[model samples]
Target: MKNRSNQQKKSDRSTSQGTSNIALMALSAVPLLMVLGNSMLIPEFPKIKSALDINQFQVGLLITLFSTAAGLSIPILGFLSDKYGRKIIIVPSVLVYGLGGIISGLGATLLDDSYLIILIGRVVQGIGAAGTAPIVMAMVGDLYKSNDRSEAMGVIEAANGIGKVISPVLGSAVALISWRALFFSYAILAIPISLGVFFLTQEPTHQGQKEKLSSYLKKILQIFREKGPSLLISLFAGMAVLFILFGVLSHVSDILEKEYNLKGLTKGLIIAIPILFMSSFSYLTGRYLKQKGKFFKIAIITGLTIVGSALFFLPFLKKPYIYVGILTIMGLGSGFVLTSVNTLVTSSTTSEQRAG
Candidate 1:
């Protein structure tokens, strides 16, 4: 009788853990979807500018505003999630993100000042998104054993690649009908996505060890004092340089059209070549990291590729095939760097600190 009861208890524990992991996976998907919506907007920039009667710079500002808001809010929301619980932050954040999309859609349809309204909506969306990506990653840190955590992180990273893959094509198609419809379509997805997260994912229980704000601040300060400076420096330097490279790449479709006289889908295909290379390399790097445990080496290779590609672009900017080759090298480099960074960040932090 005792043996049977012990077996039953073990089985119950295993079942509970399985359910928790499934929830974590679902929660992870939300951020991937959010990123998809964000990336998809990139290709639709021209259409949006045309529809709203805005200039290229103004359209660029929209992208800037969204990223800036999200980046600034991440630590704040991360702190809140640590204090309260994951679900408390996540559920509300998802709804707010969806609301932003809806508001942006409505503004695009109803208002003459659509660009202004869209900007406001993106800010709101960023606020919510700030919580989604990091928190989901933090939750994966919370739920899994240390050895399994990398695989979980890899899965999330893969989902992100999948989002990037589908977003441009899907976003472009919707924008074709009406750019406003793109926002509305994303908003609709958000509603169902949020509901899924709420119902499926459990809020991890806080272990009754709440710290005072002063202590929390002190600890956070200490974390930075010890580790923050280097990580911040690396993150900022890497992200800034890469952002400029991506900005140049973003104009490739236009370059092809203006300089090479390619049009329509052909122009898009030329632009997509880099993303395709990026996605393929991302998948391969994630798999290799899982198997080889050589993240630092891979990252170095990626960095060298980026520098080489940039140098090559200086000389061969006019040749279409050469541009593609250089960009592909850049894409491969980016994939390795991103995968390694994410793995390192997740691996280096403890659960409590990761929640921050």
Candidate 2:
């Protein structure tokens, strides 16, 4: 009976994909790769700092530069992708992303001033990173009609969480062989994935009148004024949630190794549990919202409250297991917030403003 039930479940799970869905799945790799490029580096910080002959503060700039570049470039790139086409921006962005990785790997290999060169490469990666993730999100809006958009967004968010889950383990394993290999591996993986997305996916149709820069700027301002506090709240809340998420994850390795005497694969496995909660919950939330299609505002508020509650009590914890338990709770809120709010943003404007 158990065997029959297992077989039945397997049969039920099997579903087919069209060329577009296939392409969308491949496109999902951009965020996964984008995340892996950074998150994987968490465990490698000591190695990088030592090899580059840099201090902790200078070493920290590697993350800051990539994030700074991505943040600065996203709005501009979103506008361009909207103006031009998703494919044009995405293809080139992937190429630039690979080039940046290659350059970073080479700098670490051949140069004395590896720090400066790798920093430049990371900045370049950030520039490329800026273009890809948002374009992919915009592509989701472009590719799927409104009914299917939420599911697509959920899958992408789950992919992002999965990448975070995998990065530490993958990074740790690869570091066993060579820490520099992780840099090159992203370049190697990116080329083919980008190409697959390019060839398989059809470009989303752009219609109607094109606006001048002045007109577009005015329209964007108009959107801001109309959306007002709602948009502002979403933006700030997204930032704050992630600030807690990454900020906590950033310190995990040190705490686990120093406090608990854990390292390597064991450490990586331990670090991944909360993130796994995030991904699984994100997938479920996406499905839930896709069907129920209500409580979006409520869910977002609830998610924020849950995250706040988790952070408030964290200072009193002693056991590593309890600490991780709270982090998992934080992940639950993050997953909820990610699914609902992202769908809101993607659904906010269906046409020209969707990408912008």
Q: Best-fitting candidate, measured by lDDT?
A: 2
Model 2 vs. true fold: TM: 0.80
Which 10-residue span in candidate 2 carries the lowest summed lDDT? Answer: 11-20
- Model 2 agreement with the true structure over 1-356: per-residue lDDT tens digits: 99999988776655324666787788898888888767777776766766787876786688889888988888677777777888888888888888888999999889877888898999999998888877888888878878888789777877887898998888877778787887888798789978987887787576523666677667767878888677778877776777677667656666776788876777777667777887788778878887998888888888899999998998788788887898899989988887787778657654656545
Report lDDT (Cα) of residue 279, candidate 1.
78
Tens digit per residue, CA lDDT, model 1, 1-356: 99999999999999987887778668767777777656567666666767788876787777677778888888778777777877777778888888888889899999987888999988988888887877777777777788988888778777776776666666666666776887787677777777877888765567534766577667667777778865665465457545654565556544665578764445445556667777787677767886877655457456656855675564556787877777667777776766666566556566566556
Q: Which window of 10 residues has the lowest lDDT sum in candidate 1?
A: 262-271
Candidate 2: stretches off by over 4 Å = 1-18, 49-60, 140-158, 204-209, 289-294, 344-350
Q: How accurate is candidate 2 locally (lDDT)?
A: 0.79
Best by TM-score: 1
Q: All candidates' TM-scores?
A: 0.81, 0.80
